[model samples]
Target: MTSPYNNKENITDKSSDVVWHNATVTSEQRAEQKKQKPVVLWFTGLSGSGKSTVANAVEAKLMALGKHSYLLDGDNVRHGLNKDLGFSDADRIENIRRIGEVAKLFVDSGSIVLTAFISPFISDRQQVRDLLEHDQFLEVFIDTPLEVCESRDPKGLYKKARSGEIKNFTGISSDYEAPLNPEIHVKTAEFSIEQCAEQIVDALIERKYFSF
Candidate 1:
């Protein structure tokens, strides 16, 4: 049987047959109508580092403030859009690439999209960053120490990785490239989830991504 991931033809076909369809209403119009600046809040960190926790909290805050927002989480996506992809390096790259495209659509629609993933590779994260405009992509690094992440181990994934039950596991069998200069870095160990979420909101406000 052929490997599902070995199809290169489908990946390389960017033809002119499909012209870009201009939407009747532009992104700026959508933003103006919604009264908020659209952005992709990409949260990257180790498993159990509170990426999902803090991201959800931030989304809640955004909603309470009447900002339009959506969250794309790792496990949730895997259950559907990325079900075919595995933990292999190539699969991981493709997974992030597809998500970047989806997030770009969300931004075009003028919604603040929060993505919580263990997106371990810096290059992959940078690729997603390049997909958006300069100010539209906010890299929020959940900067928790590896030891702390292992201790938290909410899913017991770290324990499995340590036991060699899970291969290519980030911060264990696989390598995780930390962001050298993320736009926002929240040290989960130093603050409460609400505080971390507020810190992100404060940054967004300070940058004038949205007011009040």
Candidate 2:
């Protein structure tokens, strides 16, 4: 996909006067203080596939274990940071790009950032993964069949999409590109929300992101 934000000339022109300033208090120091490894838990799937549900649960679990964390839900971000963006493919790409940048900053600040977004395009998700170190980025795919998602339709989005009231809705109008090698995959259709959240917490523990 072509990204208006990726224009090399535009980027160079915009960044020409900017200088990098190294902070004395580094990410490592911040993480050490927090007693947890900073990382980004990116949840991707169709809307109503339980991304936010599972993410909120996982964040609660992390907090109970004394891990510093933050959650950036798609709808919440749209209310502020990404309100100017839209549902077009280009706008979606820009949205993910901006979120990826913000998540990186959160990681740098020593917080395990949990992002709940549809992030339908594999290329867009991959772009976000490339923003962080390999171990710092964990793709959590909430795998629910479209039929199940449509049936759940918590926000009435699927119904709207089916009726043509919504355009470019993922899984209905837009294509949802499944992750090829996600670090964790939760089949939400088969698992309870608590179970899915616990599974992610276990994965984080196994990966040594934090200790309980």
Q: Could you say which candidate leads in TM-score?
A: 1
Could you estimate the TM-score for every candidate? 0.95, 0.94
State the lDDT of candidate 2 residue by residue for 1-212, as single tens digits: 96856588888898998999999999999999999999999999999899999999999999898889999999999999999899999999999999999999999999999999999999999999899998999999999999998898889988999899999999888999999999999999998999999999999999999885
lDDT of model 1 at position 40:
97
Candidate 1, residues 42-143, lDDT tens digits: the string is 999988899999999999999999999999999999999999999999999989999999999999999999999989899999999999999899999999
> What ranges in model 1 sit over 4 Å off?
1-6, 10-16
Q: How many angstroms is residue 2 displaced in model 2 relative to the true structure, after the best TM-score fit?
A: 21
Question: Number of clashes in every candidate structure?
Answer: 0, 0
